[model samples]
Target: MDKAKEIFKVTKKTLLLIAGLVWSFAGFRVFTIGLEDIINYRGNKFISILVGSVVFYIFFKFIFLKMYKKHFIRITTSGLDKQYFFQFFDLKSYFIMGFMITLGILVRASRIFNPVGVANFYIGLGFALFLSGVLFFISFSNTKKIKVQ
Candidate 1:
């Protein structure tokens, strides 16, 4: 059983790549949903897009970038030669992600806020996530280069 589980082990670089792919995919999905919502909104589309852009800038600079740096450091500093595929994110990260996802779902479903506002927020968040994924890919490349040296 142990040996079987070992087959699922992956290098840190691979983990980084996986993380990038997952985040990018999720970002794309969320972004599209937001775009669709904005398109259907009766309010001003330009304002919605603008709000989204601002949200993206703020979230990326203030939140996602910091998170990327922290996670990148953690991945690079791990002592293990091989880690489980899902180990790209620590347990705390997984829990936080779960909580955020649940919260987002609940908020969207409750419809207490305006749909246009939600769409703008989603757009901003999605862009930040996609950029964060790009950062992970860059880190993966740099780590590969270091290993080759």
Candidate 2:
């Protein structure tokens, strides 16, 4: 029983730590896009990122927090087995999640190759990837609780 509890605690901490890393990576991409836009386009991309972050925070408060609070409570109070937390993360989801993280890395790595020889296009692609990263973060955040529609 003690060993099981220790393993469970470690697993939960690892999961949360990974989530935090993903969140920070997404934030980094957003910030990088803003800096690139300012340097390349001389526009208000930085301000836009700030606005977007504020909007995301507000949305998370009203929606994600409410939804996930119930989920956390249900999972915690039900002896973990009732929730079957690991079952929610099947093989397919793992594959897809791995692909997303790999794609994000590849997108950032492309900056090194400069295969296109077009700076504007490269920056635009990066910004598009920045959007994708934000979407990835949102999707991953909600994966803990699968909603049936």
> Which candidate should be chosen as best, given TM-score against the real structure?
1
Q: What is the lDDT of residue 108 in candidate 1?
A: 94
* C-alpha TM-score for every candidate: 0.92, 0.35
CA RMSD of all predictions: 2.1, 9.3
Residue runs of model 1 more than 4 Å from their true location after superposition: 145-149
Off by over 4 Å in 2: 1-10, 44-50, 63-78, 81-149
Across 101-139, the per-residue lDDT of candidate 2 in tens digits comes to: 686568656767432222333333334434434444454
TM-score of candidate 1 against the unseen true structure = 0.92
Worst 10 residues of 1 by lDDT: 140-149
Question: Candidate 2, residue 122: CA error in Å?
Answer: 16
Query: How much is 22 displaced in model 1, in angstroms?
Result: 1.1
Clashes of 2: 0
Q: Who wins the lDDT comparison? A: 1
Model 1 Cα lDDT, one tens digit per residue, 1-149:
99999999987788889889887887887788788999888878889988999999998999889888888777767777777889878898889889988988998999999878888999999989898999888888777532311
**lDDT value, candidate 1, whole model:** 0.85
